[model samples]
Target: MSDHVEEQEMEAEALEAIFDVSFSVVHDAQPFVWSVRLVPVDCGGDESEELEHNHVAVKLVATIPPTYPEDCGPELDVEIERGLAEQHREEILGVARDEADANEGMPAIFAVCEAVRGWLADNNEKGLEDVSMHAQMMRKKKDEERSKAKQEQKFESQKKAEEMTEAELEEIAVRKRRADGTPCTEENFLAWKEQFDKEMEEEAAREVAEREREGGSNKKKGAATEIKSRRDAEREGRPTGYELFSGKAGTMNLEALEAAAEEAEEGSDEDDAVTVEDLDVDENLFDDDDDLDDLDFDDDDCDEEEPEI
Candidate 1:
């Protein structure tokens, strides 16, 4: 208990000493709260008459922690006296935190106060500099948000694209129409017409490409089939009779085969030799003299048959 008391008393003394250094100190003895007014910032006591009656200065306050500058870093807070943007409030808090960090293991209230005072002093002799700084910061934040939104939207669109099949996408593109129920104006008509024309042109181009691809594929398949057919015929190593006579085997030695065929036609396959006379016809083979001899022989046979029996 004594040690805790001693530590509190020492921290109180340090806070008092910091308050003595050209600052306005608000004392609340029960809780040991110190509202150290950092000077030279527009935290509100200057007399510039062009200001609105509702304006007041920004304020910084620190709650004296028993373990400050020893066991823990300073936790600074800002008090906005009137309407203030989140940007400036955050900036002031950041500056105080930075000062606190720089003066570690030492009482940093005065240092933090001074750092804020210097920033306010450099930025403005009058109180209105926070307005421009606040606007710029807010604009920067908005621009970042917008850029992030666009990137997210593009990512989502890409995902949707990847999910759709090529045929599905093409079908959707062709069939999509304006869904708004408002009566179409001339401007809407023209825009729709332009869009329709573009879609048609793209579709035509795609069709042409598809046709070319199909044509190339068919041509290659036909060539492959023709080559395979020729391969099958070669593997068989046999020629049809038509192929033989059609001069398809002109590259082979067929003179002896031709001679064998001629002999077979002449009924003289015992040898390949043949003569025109061997194939000639005898004109007297069916003559009348042979028919008269055949009739006389028949009459002699008829007379001899009766006596011999």
Candidate 2:
């Protein structure tokens, strides 16, 4: 057969097979470029309405060549719906092209169309399953995180309570009950706490002031103890250093010691008198040097012998 005749026969067969498929022309012109939208007719759920509308479907814009498929394959552009992803569109196109190439130069438009329809139906089933499972997983993760946080907070609260003294914990429980607006039925504890809560800061300040007063009283006690200790050391006769050298504190009590000191100083001049022999000097040596030649004097001798009177 001639090349032109064979191509025309292939074109007629391809058109007859796709007669059921709804298609439009390129740019509204009745040209060779065909724009086709294919939707799955029997997808049971939300996608079933696609059979009634052109806007929601897989789209194919193809240019079928006059030459045989052996020399020129159909140029196909596949598009998925707006909300759908492009990766699945590629998968659908790959299956469709494989089907069309298998029946080359023949009525293979239906094969390509059927391949696309199968992909869409599978996508619809798997999409619902995966989406439902993903939502369940997200809810589970959120619940687990919230539960973990609550456990950690509870552990911290328990540790804080354990660290407190028994008395301190009782005080805290009292205050907490008041803050939570509890009823005063429990031994009137709530009413008592309510009265204090109004002046809690001032009460804390008063506690500090009481401690300071106690500290000052302790200092006074320490000073009195020190004074008593010093008086005890003096009574024990620890010399107390010089009896007369004591300052105002010693003199205030040392009347007998001071009188004895006065008596001792009064006799200081006569009682402490020094004779000429005490200095080892000659008494008549100022008369002249009459016995100087007769006396044997040493040059290094500092003391002179006393002459008889």
Candidate 3:
């Protein structure tokens, strides 16, 4: 008896489980249930008042679960939700209706839920693979962009270097100026050379003229010195022409010599006259015209005939 009672409770639990599951499905289909009823009717000549056919009626006064998973199957939940909003059409509405009808029973709802769960799991795995592939593609594109930027920078640098090289070569090839900072044109160079030669020549001529002037002044000075020395000697009563001419040999006879001595003495009073000591005359001499005229006088004989000898 306890076993039978336990069996009856189990069966009641099973029936209640099925009813609850069906009610949940109906609720998912719409918003509200105004009434829910199971009516019984007798069928096939069973006149027993207790046995009848039963029909369950559920009246939806308001929509429950106001929206569907956009369209059909849980596997396509992401696609349906996105696709249905873009294309609000009869096809997507029909898909929602079919999903609701198919899940009206407890067994069907359970089977469909299991299949949808598996599909969602598979979709998540595929989404992970797609995400990985997209990340790899982004990395490759970034590397390629970096490589291109570097290549462009190098090309620009090379172009600038080449331009600089060209400018430097042009500068080197062109002639500029001389070391003295003068322009190296032919006309200018020749003009400077001529001017330099002219200046040098003028300088040489001036030097030569200075030397000649110095030499002439020295010669004039020497001549003036000689003349001054001669004049000094004359003033000092050094030998003069008159002194040499009026020696002792100049004396005649006594009277004539006396007269001559007197004339000499008188003449010596003047600065230009001969002196007595300078007169080369004889101390003793006859006053005869014949003797004076016959005197064979050589300069040496006159010197020998001097009275002092």
lDDT score of model 1? 0.63
Q: TM-score for every candidate vs. truth? A: 0.33, 0.33, 0.20
CA-only RMSD, every prediction:
24.5, 25.8, 41.8
Please, what are the lDDT tens digits per residue for candidate 2 over residues 42-115? 33334536534323367776666655455655667788753345555677778888987888766455567677
Candidate 3, after superposition: displacement of residue 256 in Å? 31
Q: Largest lDDT belongs to which candidate?
A: 1
Q: Tell me which residue pairs clash in candidate 1.
A: 43-57, 43-58, 44-57
Off by over 4 Å in 3: 1-180, 238-309
Per-residue lDDT tens digits of candidate 3, residues 134-187?
755874676698799999999999997777876686675554433336557999
Worst 10 residues of 2 by lDDT: 300-309
lDDT of 1 by residue, 1-309 (tens): 444346655765775675554344454443345566544433244345414332334578776555655766656798754444566678888999998899987767767878876765543323333568776687567669879999999999999989999899888766664443458899999999999999999999999999999999999999999999999989698867765544455422234434444565568746556543333333344366857565543433433433211
> Candidates ranked by lDDT, best first?
1, 2, 3
Score candidate 2 by TM-score against the native: 0.33
Q: Candidate 3 — what's its lDDT?
A: 0.44
Q: Give me candidate 1's TM-score against the actual structure.
A: 0.33
Provide the lDDT at 301 for model 2.
Answer: 32
